[model samples]
Target: MLQRKLAALLILLPSSLSLTVTAQQQTPSNPVAPSQLALALPATASLSTEESHKPAFESSSAEGVIRITPAPQLEKELPSQRPFRTAAFGIKANTLGAGAELATPLFGRFNLRSGVNFLAFAYPFGIDGVNYNANLHFKSSQSTLDWFPGGHAFHISPGILYSKNTVSSAATVPAGQNFTLGDQSFINSVGDPVHGNMSLAYPRTLSPMLLLGFGNILPRNSRRLSVPMEFGVAYTGAATINVNLTGTACTNDGCTSFGGNSEVQASLTQEIHKINEDLKKVPVYPILSLGVAYHF
Candidate 1:
């Protein structure tokens, strides 16, 4: 019995000592480092390693969650930096005749056109034996500044051509018929018949143009119809002729008074100085057009 009691006491003592040692060892040795478990989390469950690799239906607004993000795309304007947005209206023909035009857009590729043209006619002729009756008028007006270049439809213009062309005539010489002036030769007095009047003018009524074109009546995408064509020159100068005669003429030494003939007014001033030296060798005036346009 004594031995059994001693054994129990020793066992109890050992058990108590063991329990104390175990408690001391359970505190912590070295397993908690993900930066110490993210500092024991809870600053809203702290997560950073790039928010634990984002996109878990990514949210924000402090988790009241609201972030859609997909609107921001507006920047489009480059038809040569558009200007005067759009405008075009046209109708045309050529050689300064039937026309009506108006175009706008004056920036970048540049444009600005304007127009007006008209024509009138009536002619019936015979020159020398003189029996004319002509009347031709062609009014005009223009304004331009096109230049396309790289935005090409090919163009280049620079203009201003305002004219009111004319050519009037009304002459007859049938009483004994026969005529000629500078070189002198005439007849037509019987009952006085050799009345005359002639005119042709354009001493200069604004002209200074230069063009070269090929389609493009304000066209910068979204086409709204176009068809334009041009070729030009206009420096209108020298074109003036005027002649007037009353009646009575016949020379083989007889009737006279082509206004009291001083040799028929010096052969009508040498036939108006040889018809103004052949219209000063044409001082430009030739343009060609063709069109149909509409835009807005």
Candidate 2:
């Protein structure tokens, strides 16, 4: 009876009775084979593949974020100034403001220069102990030849200067000031100021000019830019000074008008004629200039 009971109990149980060990979140002793795991749990296999590549993806992302890259910088450029030329078309500036010239190499160490300078100015001066003021309206044209005897850096020039310079003034002498017009001493009526009109005419004829100069400001085969200086003189013709005199003056402390006297008037005319005689000694006009010029 015991044998039967044991057998019957055994039979009542399943034919293959074994405990199934399940680990949803634990690693197996031996890892699941790729083929078996794919068949058994496809999601598990896919999750394993994703986790295997996670470290590499993280490493790649880190490399992208933490990189030492040099920044690109930009630079700018500026234009350069040009130097002088050997033969050029140049513009020069001096006391005359502006003038244009053509500079060409003629014979060796020689250059021909021709240009004109003009200006209208008012100049006041004291000449031969006489105070004089005049408006200078002048135009001077030069036909000069430059000789670079001392190389290209220094030169001596000889030229013809045609000058059309004149002076005109409405002259007034202050009271108590004795002025010499022509060759006589004239005082404004002792207590009154005298007013008169005067004019001085200079020769417009061609005059001789001599100049000593330094530097070729225009670009040559050597230097590009330089400061040019020149000192010269022009032989101006005798000046003809004409004065129209009509004024009132007091004499002998009696306040008599001396301008109304025929004798005084005659004396004034004689004095006026003496101006040409007084200026007979001076006939040269000085020339000096510092200028900048550029070659083409």
Candidate 3:
């Protein structure tokens, strides 16, 4: 019985050994490394801790590739887009008179300006022994185109001046007092003073004007107020003088009608010619002004 049992045990041991050899042959000889394992797996199998916690705007593809896209940035503003101030109004004091003005922008570095001026006063003087009360009056309207060459406060202006200016006088001579008109000397008739009227005026009412100035009525920046100053001239042409007399006068001979006297008329014509000749020397009227203005 011992010999039989030994035989059966040897057969079963051989069969188990054969099965173990077969399983060992089917298995791999070397284990895979972590790096190799990762390459072997699908691309979406895993993600890094840092990549998993990224912001929504940043993203990673299923291929394990990172595609970071930056957010859009805001745009900046431009100077031309700023609000434009349209007009300005102001008061001024000038050689012509006290006045007010309006200014408006026309285009880049250009402006339009318009204003009016007025002044009236009296002066007393004596010419050729004639006591005269003279009234000087000034009224004018002007318009100009202002140009800023370097986009600065300094500007040049060309314009027109429409004037209603006059110099009028009342002439008188004391009764029996001597006076000269033209080249003739005469005496006022006793009980009758030599009374007359004289007027000086420009031949042209519209004159061309040119100006150079500092400061601007409408500033380009954020300022709301400015002080403007200007110096210029207007070509007004020669002035004309007229004289009329309505009183009695006496020459060496005798008293006669002052208005009807041929000698008196001739003298008056000569005097007028002389006055006009002097005026022709100065055909331009001066302009100077300073002002405060507000812009809107």
Candidate 4:
């Protein structure tokens, strides 16, 4: 009876142990805590590549934001350079007026002249018979060619001039009678007796002249007054083709031939006679003048 009881108790203990092991294997493990999940999340990502490409600056308490690069500055240029200059020219004024250019180098090589001039002169009266007076009026239009030849000291100008001179006279005749007379009585040895005569004289003249001159310059600048001495010769002749006068005269010396009568010599009466006087024209002559010149 004791042996059987011990064996039954051992078998029952073994079965109970097996049952406890199986129950523990079927149970699930505990879930993780919410706080631990929050800690495991990735930190915020660094600035992206797109953001890094843009301009960037650092903010700080000690220094304000500083620009990393400045905008391109506009280029400046100076004005194009050129030389400064003043313009100039030469002009002259003279006695000849604005047109009257004294031969000077200011107006390049050529010169022009224009003006009015007055001439008053007297020449010896060529004849002895009567009284004579002469007056000349000169009007001129001219152009000149100047030759430098060397210095400004000298020049030559060839030109033309037109002029007029008037000559007039009056004479007293001696009182006398011709003996070729008995009713005709007024005749003498010479064509007519000049013993007593009175008459008026007239001479009118016109002349065209070719002139050439030589001058000596003292010294002057353009627009200044200068002294120049000029001498010129002119060939001039009257416009009238034939300028001649001829006349007959008779003179008696108190001797008479009255039919050869001799009665107390008849007061010594003279016979009438015939005489002739010839006056010729003067063809060409020379003229001289002196004057000053001005330049403006």
Q: Provide the overall lDDT of each model, using Cα atoms, as 2-decimal numbers.
A: 0.82, 0.63, 0.85, 0.35
What TM-score against the true fold does each predicted structure earn?
0.39, 0.58, 0.69, 0.36
Question: What are the runs in model 1 whose C-alpha is more than 4 Å off?
Answer: 1-48, 51-59, 64-68, 72-87, 90-99, 102-116, 119-136, 139-145, 148-165, 169-195, 201-208, 211-262, 269-271, 274-295
Candidate 4 TM-score, true structure as reference: 0.36
Most accurate candidate by TM-score: 3
Give the total clashing residue pairs for model 2: 4
Q: How many backbone clashes can be found in candidate 4?
A: 35
Write the residue-wise lDDT of candidate 3 on 1-296 in tens digits: 99999999998999999999998899877879899998887665576665778777666666665657877897643222233447889899998899999988877788899999999999999878888899999999999999999888899999999999999999888888888877888888877777888898998899999999998887877788899999999999988888777788888888888778788788878877887888899899989999999987
For candidate 1, lDDT tens digit of each residue in 118-231?
988888886667677888899999999998888868999998898889989887788887788889898888787878788888878898999998878777777778888899
Tens-place lDDT digits, model 2, residues 46-145: 4554456564323223113223455678743211112122454445554533555555555556777677777788878653333557887877778778
Worst 10 residues of 3 by lDDT: 76-85
- Residue 209 error, candidate 3, Å: 0.8
The runs of at least 3 residues in candidate 4 whose Cα sits more than 4 Å from the true structure, single-residue gaps closed, are 1-108, 120-128, 171-223, 238-250, 253-285
Q: What is the C-alpha RMSD of each candidate to the true structure, in Å?
A: 12.3, 16.0, 9.8, 27.1
lDDT of 4 by residue, 108-175 (tens): 32233323334444433322231223333333333344443444556655555433433323222223
Which pairs in model 2 have colliding backbones? Answer: 84-219, 84-224, 85-219, 189-249
